[model samples]
Target chain A: MSSLSRTTFASLIFGFSFLYLPLIFTAIFAFSDAELAGVWTHFSLKWFKAILNDEDLLIATFTSIRIAGISATVSIILGTLAAAATMNTPRGKYDGYNFLKRIILLPIMIPEIITGFSILMLFMVIESMFGWPKERGILVVAAGHSVASVAYVYATVSSSLASLDQSMGESAINLGAKPIHVFFHITVPLSWRAIVSGWFLAFILSFDDLVIASFLTGPGTSTLPIVIFSNIRVGVTPTINAFVTVFVVITIILASIVYFRTLCLKGRRKGRSATR
Target chain B: MSKKVVGFFLFITLLIVILQWKVKDDYSGEVVNVYGWYGIIPREIFNDFEKETGIKVRYDFYDNNEMLEAKLLSTNNGYDIVFPSFIPYASRQLLMGIYSKLNRKLIPNIKNIDGIITSKFGANGGDVQFLVPLFWGTIGIAYNKKVVSQLLPGETIDSYDVLFDLSKISKLFPYGVSFPEEYIDILPQTRKFLQLKHGGESVTDFQECFRFLEKVRPYITKFSSTTMISDLLSGDVCIAIGASDNAYRAMRSSKAVDKDIQYTLPKKTGILWIDCLGVPKKAPNKRNAYLLINYLLSPEVAAKITNHSGILVNLPAALPLINAEIVTKKDICQSDPEVLEGLTMGCARAENTRELIKAWSQYKTNTHHTSINKEASK
Candidate 1:
């Protein structure tokens, strides 16, 4: 066997074990009624019952879904349009394009606490000035996440756009089809996979966020991860483990589909692919 | 193959979505929600109270008081019975007003309170009620005797001074001691020591605590809240200092397994903390809360909790009923020694706490590098 294939196989085994071993422990502990994690004398589903009935956690979960959905939609719209514009340009031609990309990435790159603090201060100042208080509710949190998520979506869509045969659009144009028509029919339909995956990817990033959400979230509007974090600060109970197992399973499945689909798409495209 | 896989994925996705959406919290009646810390308190006490008075008790716990305090400070927190650290309760005015109007007639055991604690909560010139002091304890170090014996010079280590004194113990804890990175416990110790050495004031903010924590920074192997107690018992650590109750836990757990564990009472105790119960001003089940407080004050319930939790309760009746075996064994760290040793008295003195807090913050800042379990100390 080639060294490349062997190295790849070894790393895959190591990485999967590293990630899922603890998750498996969490899953195991979720079935038990032991007060402490160490000695497990009994197995019970009581914790799952508590988690399912928890009002605050349920509210936080709903809040996360709503916020994630809104953020993803807004981010993908801006990201796809930006990708559509940027993909055709030769890499070095636009002098300030790199700077624009950096600006878009500032939310994701800087320390989250710093970003959170700055936005909170900015919100405070705006409220004081306008007397509008501009409501730092779920809407503001969604906007904050969208700003960060745009970079991911932009990266995903632009690469997918670049993979398209440039001649296909030109050929359609040559046949007297309008440019907008060519884009809507030919380009969008073909790239829906990337766009949909990017949207889901953005959704996960936004949903899982805690630090930014904690600061930006107004009274009674925290997301699920924030609630989970608050609960964890007290203690780790099997109930929380149950809730988290569900999250783990859901995310793993979503991530697996996203991963394999990209692999298949890239296999077909050949030149550029997500490294996974 | 692909169609079936895709169909299965869609089915699971829809199930999760529906499950998450369908799980909603509907509140009807007869329950007073509580947020507190987990300890030796039994559910039977709460159940008995519920049976006598028809108010159901739903309890939740925070690892430390800060998280609870933060939640209480939020506008919409609906907790009716909030158990906060005595110092934390002292730091805020949120509960003071609610306490001022408690009907003493309903709680016949109110007379059983030790005079000192009663004075702490009782009315002044007017009816200014503070929290009913339920449990009180001193901060000290709890250690595994086996590990600490190894640290002793010629097997003789016995004191807190043996901990930080480099001359007597050159490399006893090369990888520092295990203590939580918290403002309440560590910051105060740093403040007291730094003041003794450098004569600085107290601190209250994160920046100040950063400086405070930095002084003892190198001595800290790792700062953890709840982990330090179990780790010390399991022999992963030589010694850890914070609350005596956790030390009592280590001692009791060892006794259960027939191992020697020692929790040393320091020459000068860092802080005296009290955990108290109070009903919110807007408690839906105020009668139930009153009945529960009365029930907790009962001799049997109080003795069981104080014995199991290793915290000293204020009830005079409860004190006599506690198992003499535990107290005599020093399985519990006593506050009388703490008072005799002159614990900094940080829990009281509300007017002066801000400055103390400021100094405490500075001390924590000093030990910031080793800070992780900031809430653990509380």
Candidate 2:
């Protein structure tokens, strides 16, 4: 048993190293003095300073974050509602709930380039017909990202909803609780963890998107990924390394806080249930 | 509060913010979108232009001429001024009536342009009003001098022969050569050397061009449009077939670390590419666009662009203001009168572009297999 556990641990170490070694090298290169990452002349923070001073990059980052936050929130709300409605539909009825599920997940099934191009064409047609969205900007990017993120949110929320005891909700309704009150008071408290996880997953998907954002963005509204990609043609500058390192650090901190808080809450709930 | 109530509040807050938050234009004043290749326009130039004219210059980049063409075809994208190379891309667009005629009266600084510069676009520019010449240079070889000397002692650095006849030098630097990935740039030089070898009469069709590329494809280790300089600096590639600006940049970058990166034009003749600025027909800010063009044509601005971008500026007035190191170097400027006689300039409409694109795709697929097989063997 000990030997088997050792072998398993070794393989896990190897697997994780393969995944994260490049990011480690990137972080090291972010602080390197030379233009190329091969040389290690000394430590430097000039690239970080350069990134701060670059107005274009800052504006793009702001646009990316703003779009990601809005899109993720929108996706979570719509996805949870859709998932709840689909779950409530009787399994044998097949009364268009199945169709609704398939259509809602269609954007994720389609290739990203196709999705981006189709959304762009749709916006173009709408613009021509009704003069809506006269200009392509961050809002169009949010719309595209939200559409793509919805499926992930729906999958997570609906899977958790399916595992829950429907009898609990029925009992709450029977005890004179209104449908809305039961949903808010009973159903939501039970699936809160999955809902939060889905929100974060959607957030990541929207935040890291490049292809869809590229099609939807127009003049004066470049995203961080777009700017970084364009600048890379001049050869890989350390500024992008610095920018990515900062992004990674923020993500780690936020994820850590969420993970620990969830762990603590779960532990406290277990203790409460044991006492009961 | 219940988690559901909190989630509802967060969702509502986000909706309100997204709906209320607008994508404010970065520039408040008159704006002109200048689309070109990456790093073609330096930041200082934009700031200076904006300060001088109060017309905010919004710059964007596309990796290839095809993307630019697609964008232009798809939308009246509100781009005022665009900078593009003459042949293959812009020339094709010119034929389609995509570019607007310039109002010469507004651009008084056009007088500063040399005859050679004006004529470089077309036969007396075909229609001088269509585009203004920005910078011009020859496409040639950027090679590591030490590597070349050891490869072939007593051989002169000039000639497309070293690149085309790679079988002879394969032993010296096996799998050392690289070419730009773009066929638009590659085909012109490939055809030039092919004509030089087989005479103009023998080299007739796109098949011949494709054939030459195939013959030399094996010796090429990498075909990358960017990273030409970094590749040289890292010693991954000893020689690259690239345009003047990149070649100059590579040489400068390598020299900073005491590496002797040398650039040479083909001995007797070479292919020339001229980057020009033209306004789109539906440009909204026509007056500001003209002002920007005229300002760019001014000797100081022209000279700054040349020095910074490392392309040859043809404005004679700006010649004195250019970096002396570049203006003085023969390989960089290519000003030899006798050698000038041998140079072949690219045409406005070189050939059936569809055929050219097809041949290029075939070459790429063939090369891809060749490289894969070679890699597997190794």
Which portions of model 1 miss their true places by more than 4 Å?
A2-105, A118-147, A162-188, A216-276, B1-115, B118-135, B150-176, B183-220, B248-270, B275-344, B347-378
Can you write out model 1's per-residue Cα lDDT over B1-378, one digit (the tens) per residue?
Answer: 334434534654664455335422213356666666554465566777778777767654455565566555543345567777665453364435534345677777766666555454442111224467777766776766665566664654334565556543345465347775554665555445444432233234333445444544556565665665556544566677767776666666555334576776555535666677776664556666666777788888888887766767767677678888557755253536334344554434355456545544444455443332344355
Best by TM-score: 2
**For all the predictions, what are the DockQ values?**
0.08, 0.41
Write model 2 residue lDDT over A97-119, tens digit each, in one string: 88888888787789998888888
Encode model 1's per-residue lDDT on A41-113: one tens digit a residue.
4688877787766666776787788788778877887888787666644568897876876676565678777
Q: What RMSD, rounded to one decimal, does every model reach?
A: 8.8, 4.5
Give the runs in model 2 whose Cα sits over 4 Å from its true position.
A1-6, A37-42, A168-190, A263-276, B1-8, B11-29, B124-127, B172-175, B196-203, B256-258, B312-314, B336-342, B347-351, B367-378
Candidates' lDDT values, in order?
0.63, 0.74
* C-alpha TM-scores of all predictions: 0.62, 0.88
For model 2 the local lDDT of residue A196 reads 77
DockQ measured for candidate 1 = 0.08
